[model samples]
Target: MDDPRSRILPLLRQGERLLWVGQPDPRVRFTGADALLVPFSILWGGFAAFWEFMVVTTAKEPFFMLWGIPFVLVGL
Candidate 1:
């Protein structure tokens, strides 16, 4: 009754056997696509942030400034 597998015992079928209990490695590993994606993301995010800044600071139209908020968030 002290076994770790006891936690899941209720969910098993009448004759089922527990063979393995494990979790995947928690790690971050970048791949080849990241070489291209990293720079592109930086450019897109930078432009979006700049546009939002300009709209918020100098643009007088409320609707135009508000529209850029979503773009800035997505860029992040």
Candidate 2:
């Protein structure tokens, strides 16, 4: 309980080995990659939300909605 790693180590079985452990940095910084990824992620999320909303609200047969279910679930 004192350390998070203590809880994780017990779950490994025989012959299983952990190679490396690291903590995430707390600092937030913007970079060139973010400039491209941020917009795509936003557009994807918006589309997924709109698609799901339309499926639930308007569609009757909704076979096309099946195609978008995985994309909507992953986007959110």
Judging by TM-score against the true structure, name the best candidate: 2
Best of the candidates, lDDT: 1
* Root-mean-square deviation (CA) per prediction: 6.3, 3.1
- C-alpha lDDT score of every prediction, in listed order: 0.83, 0.80
* Clashing residue pairs found in predicted model 1: none
Lowest summed lDDT across 10 adjacent residues in model 2 is found at 19-28
Tell me how far the alpha carbon of residue 39 in candidate 2 is from the true structure, in angstroms, after superposition.
Answer: 1.8
User: For each candidate, what TM-score against the reference?
Assistant: 0.58, 0.66
**Per-residue accuracy of model 1 over 10-72 as CA lDDT, tens digit each:** 789999988887666668577789999999889988998998788878987899888888877
Return the lDDT, model 2, position 61: 47
Off by over 4 Å in 2: 1-11, 25-30
